[model samples]
Target: MDQKIIKVITGQRRVGKSYLLFQLIRLIQEREPAANIIYINKEDLEFSFIKTAEDLNKYVLANKVEGTKTYVFIDEIQDIENFGTALRSLLLKEDLDLYCTGSNANLLSGDIAGHLSGRYVEIEVYSLAYPEFLAFHKLAENNKSLDKYLKYGGLPYLIHLELEDEVVFEYLKNIYSSIVYRDIINRYSVRNTTFLEQLVLFLAAHTGSIFSAKKISDFLKSQRVNMAPNQVQTYIQHLVNAFLIHKVARYDLVGKRLFEIGEKYYFENLGIRNGLWGYRLEDRGKIMENVVYNHLLFKGYKVQVGILGNKEVDFIAEKDGEKLYVQVALTINNPDTLEREFGNLKNIPDNYPKKVVTMETFSGNTVEGIEAQDLRSFLLA
Candidate 1:
C-alpha cells in the first residue's frame, strides 16, 4: 500500500509477476482516468532500442505528459544495462511513481543495492494459491479438485491447457527447460549442465526430506558421477538464487537454536517437481508435505522445519507473534500414523495452536488436545 517507494516485484519466471503488473495498471486506470502511465516491456521487440539508462530516461521524458504525476511500469528492468542508474535518474523527478518486475534475484543484489541505496521496496510474488487456483479454473471445492491440483500442480497457465496427461507433462517440461536454460545456465554460464540436471532431479525426487550437499555428492558418487561437495553446494545456491527451489533450515525447539546441517528443500511449484519426476504417485506423503509448506508460505508465515527433541514437526509457522505448529500427512486413518503426527506437536510446551492436516475428510476430532483438519478446508481457509 506504500505507493511512494519504488515497488520492485521479484520471483521466478511465469509465476504471474507480469500479470500482477497488468492488474495494478488496471486498478490505477480505474481509479484515475487521466493518470499519466508509461508502460515498457523490455521483452517486447518494439522497445529493443531502449537498452540503457539514457535511452530509458529519454523515452520516458518524451512520452510523459506534463503537469500530471507519471506512473512508470517496466517489466524485466534487469534486461537494461545499469537499470539502477535509470531508476535513480527518474527518482529525482518530483511526481513519478515507479514499479518494475524481474525474474532473477540479482536485480536486487549488492551492486543494485549500492546504486538504489534503500530507495525501493520489494514484493515477492508466487504462483497461485489453492483458493486462487480454484477461482481461476472455476472448479468446485471437492475431493476431485484437490486430486487434480495435487497431480497437475498450480502453474497459472496450466488452467488453459487441456488436462490430458501428455499435454500437461509437455508444458511442464518446457517450463523446466526454460527456467534452467535461460534463468540458470545462460545467466550464470553454468558449465556442468549434466550435474545441474541430476542435482535438480535429485532435489525434486526428495522434496520434503532433509539432506546436505555432501550427502548428495556421496549419493552421486555411488552412481559413478564425480562431483565435489563444494561444487554441489555452489550449484544448489544457483538454483536458490533463481527461485527454482527453497531451502528451509531446522529449528530446535528444546535448544532454541537453528542447525546448519540437515536442511530441507521444496520446489517453487509442484508442477515443476511432477514434471521432473514423471508425476509418480509413489511418494504422496512427501509431496503432500511440500504442498503444505507452500500453503503456509502463501499465508505469509515465516516457516521452518521444527525439531522437538529428536522427532520432526512438519512446519513451525510464525507471523506477527502468532505461531502455529503444523504436521502434514496424506492420511491419519491408522492409529500409529495419528500418534506419530499428533505426538510430535504434544512434545512442544507452547500453548499456541497445534494442528494436524491430512487428506482425510474432517471427522471434527481432536487427538490429544491437537486439532486435526482436512487439507481441503485448510487450503480454502
Candidate 2:
C-alpha cells in the first residue's frame, strides 16, 4: 500500500477487499488527518448522487473540497461508468492518490488501463491463508487445525464459530453471483449465463485434474452441455475474471514449449469448492492441492500446475524469479505411489528446489533430492 502510487486491490468478492480498504483508509486518516479524504462506495444505493463520471465530477466541484493533498477511496468502482476518466481527471488536477477496489481485472483492462497507464498499481487480496485462518479461529498449529481448514476453508467471517454455514455460504454465493452477473455478464453483455454457471461448477468439481477445452467441450456435448471450443474458452475466461477459477498451463521446462492441451483450474477458495461438491471424502486430495496452491499464491508466488513428460507435479511456483516444484498427495502410502512421486522430481534437470507436500502431519525432511513435509508443517512454515 505504501509503495503503490495509485493502489487498486482486486480479488474474489467477500475476500476482504472492502474491509482491507476501510482499514487502510482509517490508518491513513489517523496518521494524517490533514489529508483531505473522500470515501464513496458506488454499491451504496443511498448514494444515488454518484452513478456516473459527470455525477462524481459535479459533486466534487460543488463540495469545494480543495486541498494540497487528497485521498479518494472508491469501492466497487466498476459500477461507475467511465470511472477511469473520472479518476484520471482528479489525479491530473491535484496531488491526489486514488485507491479503488474491484472483484475482477476487467475493471482495469480496456479503458481503465489506457486511461491510467503508468499511473497505477494493482494488488491481489485473497482469502485468509492457513496461518491467518488459524489465528481467526483461535486454533493452534497442528494436524487437527489443518484438517479443519481443509474442510471449512479460510473465509475470515467463517472463522467465527457462531457464524452458521447457512449465513456464510449465502454471503459467499451472493458475492460470486454479483461477480458473474454484474462484472461478467452485464459488462460483457453475455447471453449464455447457463453455460457459464455449468462451466464454473464443472471446473469446481474437477479442480486438480488435467483438462483441456476440447475435453470439456466434448464432455459438455455428450452431456448435452453443448458449446464450441471458442465458447468454452470464453466461459473459462469469464470464470477467471470472477476469480472463481485459475487455469495452470503445462510448461515443460526441458522442452520449453508451453502446451495448450491439458491444464488444471483451481478454485480460489477450497470452502467454495466444498460447497459445490458437498464435501466428500473422495475430494480430499483436491482439497489439499487447493490449499497448497493458495498458500503459495498468498506468499507471493506465481503458481501453476507443473507438467514433466508423463509425470505430473502438483504446482510450479516462482518467487523473485526462482522456481519451486511441488506435489500434493493424500499419502505416499504404497511403495509404488511413493516411488512415482519422488521419481518425477528426481529426473528434473536443475536444482531449483523440489518438494512433496502432504497431510501426513510430520516435520519436514529432504528425501531423494526433494523435500517431504506434512501439510501442517508446510502451511505453518
Candidate 3:
C-alpha cells in the first residue's frame, strides 16, 4: 500500500482502470483509516485546472500533511502535461506514496520511462478474464455462459447492460470508438482516420492469422486504400500501444528464435472485435484462438505464435522460466483436426505441458501424452 516507487496502472480506455484505482484507495482506507489521501481524476471536469506539472505539484503539495505518508492517486495521468516531471518530483518526497493510472502503454515506453527509469513499476490491466466475466455477469459456468463471453467479450462495464446483441454490441462499439478516437487518433495525431479504422477492421477480421506490414499494406491497396508499409506499421503500433490489440510474434520452435516477418494480432476485448466486425459462426475457430490467447495472457503468461516447420502451434505460453505449448481449435472431432492440433504440440521435443483446447468436451483424454481440454475448463483452470 505504501511504496516509494510509482505504481503505474495502465490499460486501454474504459477497461476499469479507474475502478481499479478506487479499489486500491478502498484497500488503503481500510488499512490506514487516518491516512492522508490526495485524489485527482483528470477525466473529471473539476480537475481541469490541473493541466501542467506545476498545477499538479502545487495541488498535491498544498494538500500534503506533515510527518505523514500521503497516498496520491491520479487517474489518467497522461492528461497532465509533463506528468513525468511532476511524478519525479513527487516521488522524491519520502512521505508521499505515488500511484497513477494511464490508458496508454506509450506513457511507460516513451519519455516517462526516460524520466522515471527504475523508479516506477507498471501494472498492465486488461479486460475481465473469463472467470471474472462469469462472476461479473452472475452467470453459472456453462456453455451458454461461455457463448455469451465469447460473443460479448469481457469488458467489465458490460455487467450493467443487458446481454443482447443490440444492447451489448452498441455499448461495445461506442467503447471501441472512444479507444480509437481518443487513445489512438488523438494520442498519436493520426492523420488518416479512414486507414486506421480499416486497419482495425482488417485485424479483427483476420484475428489469429499471421501476416506482415507489407502483406497488410498490399491487401489494403487491393481494397483501394493505398498506405505505405511503414505507415501501416506505424498505425498498427499505435493500436498496440493503446492496448486495443496485441501483436504476438511467430516463434520458431526448431531455431529457438522469433520470426520478424509474420505476427498474429488478437484484440484486447472480443466484444469490441465482434461489435466492430459482426460475430459469425464461420469465424468460430479464429474467435476460439483469440479467446485462448487472452486467457493465456490473463493468467500472466508471455505468449507467442509457435512455428514448427510446416505446422503451426497456436500459442507458446511461458511464465516463471517455465514453458507451455497450447494449440487452439474449434473441435478435434475429425481425425485430421485432432492430429494437427496434437501433432504440432507433440512435435515440440521439450515435454513442458502441451495441450489442445477446443469447444468440444472430452473425458480427460490425452492424445499421445498431449492433453485435451474443453475451452471452459481451460479458461477456468
Candidate 4:
C-alpha cells in the first residue's frame, strides 16, 4: 500500500476497473480527509480538451494544490496522446502519487513501456467471481444461483440490471462489439472483420475444447470461410491480447511437460459467450468446465489442464505450494461419467487434494478417494 510507483489497473472494458478506482478514492478519503486528490476521467467530455501530454500536465498542475501531497487518478489514460510523457513528467514530483486505468493492452505496448522506463506496477482486473455475484444479488449460494451465474456470468452490470435476460443480452452484445471494434479491429487494423467475427463465434461455441490454429482454419474452411492457419493464429492472438478470451495450455502430468499444440480457449465472460450464440445450451458440459476454470482463476490459483497417460483432468490448480486436482462435469449420474471424472484423478500418484465438481444437488460423497462436490458448493468454498 505504501509503494510509490505508478499503479496501472487494466482489463476488458466494463469489467469494473473504473469502479475499483472509485472505491480506492473512497478509501483514501476516509483514511485522510485532508489529502489532496485529483481525479480525471478521459471518457468525460470535460477532459476532451486535454488530449496531448502537455495539455494533461498543464491541467494537472493547474488543479493540484501546492504544499501538499497529491494523489492523481486518471481513468482510460490511453485516450490521451503520449500519455506516458505526462505520467513520466508527473513522476518527477515527489509529492504526487499516480494511478491510472486503461481498457486495452495498448496501454502497455512496447513504445509506451519504453517511454515509462518500467516504473509502474500492473494490476489486471477480471469480472466478479461466483461468490461476489451471490453477494451482489443478495442471493444464497445454491443450485439456482449457480445456474444463473453459469448462464449469465459474473459481469457486474448484469447484476446491476437484476439479470433480466433481454437487457443483459443487449448490454453484452454492445460490449462485445465495442471490444471487437475498438480493441481488435481499430488497434490491429484488421481488414477481414467478417473472418474475425467468425473466428470469435467459432471460439465462443467451442470453448473448453482442444484445437489448434490449423484445426480452427480447417473448420472455418469447411464452413466456406477459407482462412489460412497463420492468419487464424494472428487473429486469435489479437483476441487474447484484447483480454476477450484466454488460452489454457495443456500440461502432461506424468511427464511434467507443457504441450504447445491443441490448447483450449475460454471466454473472459460467459455472458458474452452466450450473447454470441443467442443463449444456446448446446454444450453444457464444456461450459461447466469453462466456468470451473474461471472460478479457479478467481481463487488466485495457477491453473492448467492435466493430462495423465490417456486421461485428462479438467483442472490442476496450485497456489503457494498447495495443489488441487479438479474434474468438472454437468452430472455424474451415469456410472461411466462418474468413473471417467473420478478415475482420472485417481491416476495421480501424489496425495494432493482431488475433487470432482458437478451440477448434482446432493453432496458429501467420495469416488475412488476423490471428493464429489456440487458445483455451487465448490464455487462457494
**Best lDDT among the predictions, by candidate number:** 3
* lDDT per residue as tens, model 2, 206-290: 8888888899999889989889988898788877877877777888767877786888888888777776666788888888888
Error of 3 at 303 (Å): 0.5
The digit string of per-residue lDDT tens for model 1 on 63-173 reads: 887888889999988778788888888888877889999887888884367788678888888778888888878999888888778777888998789877789888988
Each candidate's lDDT (Cα)? 0.87, 0.79, 0.91, 0.86
lDDT of 3 by residue, 233-335 (tens): 9999999988999999998989999898989999999999999999999999989999999989989999998888988988889999999998888888899
In model 3, pairs of residues that clash are none
**What is the C-alpha lDDT profile of model 4 across 13-119, one tens digit per residue?**
89999999999999989999998889999889988998999998998898888898888999988878888988889888888889999877768875357777668
Against the true structure, whose TM-score is highest? Answer: 3
Q: Model 2's lDDT to the true fold?
A: 0.79
Question: Backbone clash tally for model 2?
Answer: 0
Better of 3 and 4 by TM-score: 3
Measured on C-alpha atoms, candidate 4 has an lDDT of 0.86
Error of 1 at 89 (Å): 2.9
List the candidate 2 regions with Cα displacement exceeding 4 Å: 1-4, 61-64, 160-167, 363-365
